[model samples]
Target: MGSMDRGLRALVGIGLIAWGVTAQNWWGAIGIIPLFTAAIGWCPAYLPFGLSSCKTPK
Candidate 1:
């Protein structure tokens, strides 16, 4: 969830979205949604479990 992680996540999300749209597959778009969460540095999927890879020095 650091800056780099956020950036990478955003990039990956964009890629997924593009692929999804180009492939005309709704499932692909659905898959990209998680990338958006990661890009924002806040994952709902991880929230419940309190998981994070951020290096903010606690």
Candidate 2:
């Protein structure tokens, strides 16, 4: 994924985890999805649509 996409995902994941921790809820587990994807720079959800956030090489 592109830098912007990765950064946004990481931010969102961190936010969710923080919210979950503060609230002491299991929902915080959901944050792993975005966090993992961001770390790997890949999102499985984007596969079927053939979408990509990374810029193409010139």
Candidate 3:
């Protein structure tokens, strides 16, 4: 994944987690997916379609 993609995912993950905490619900647990992916710099969902946000070198 690219830096921008990772950053966005991290932000979204944090937001979801915060929302879950404030609402005191299990739904926030879903945020872990993005957070984990961002940390690992890999997204399984992108593999099948051969998609990537990273820029290719010349």
Candidate 1 has its poorest 10 consecutive residues by lDDT at 31-40
The number of the candidate with the highest lDDT is 3
Write down the worst ten-residue block by lDDT for model 3: 8-17
lDDT score at residue 53, model 3, on the 0-100 scale: 99
Question: Per-residue lDDT of 4-58 in model 1, one digit per residue for the tens?
Answer: 7677777777887888889998756764775877655676677788877777565
Which pairs clash in the backbone of model 2?
A: none
Sorted by lDDT (best first), the order is 3, 2, 1
Off by over 4 Å in 2: none
Residue 46 displacement (Å), model 3 = 0.3
Alpha-carbon runs more than 4 Å astray in model 3 = none
**TM-score of model number 3:** 0.98
Pairs with steric clashes in candidate 1? none
CA RMSD (A), model 1: 2.4
Residue-level lDDT of model 3, residues 2-54, one tens digit each, is 99999999999999999999999999999999999999999999999999999
Highest-TM-score candidate = 3
Could you tell me the C-alpha RMSD of candidate 2 in Å? 0.7
Candidate 2 TM-score versus the reference: 0.94
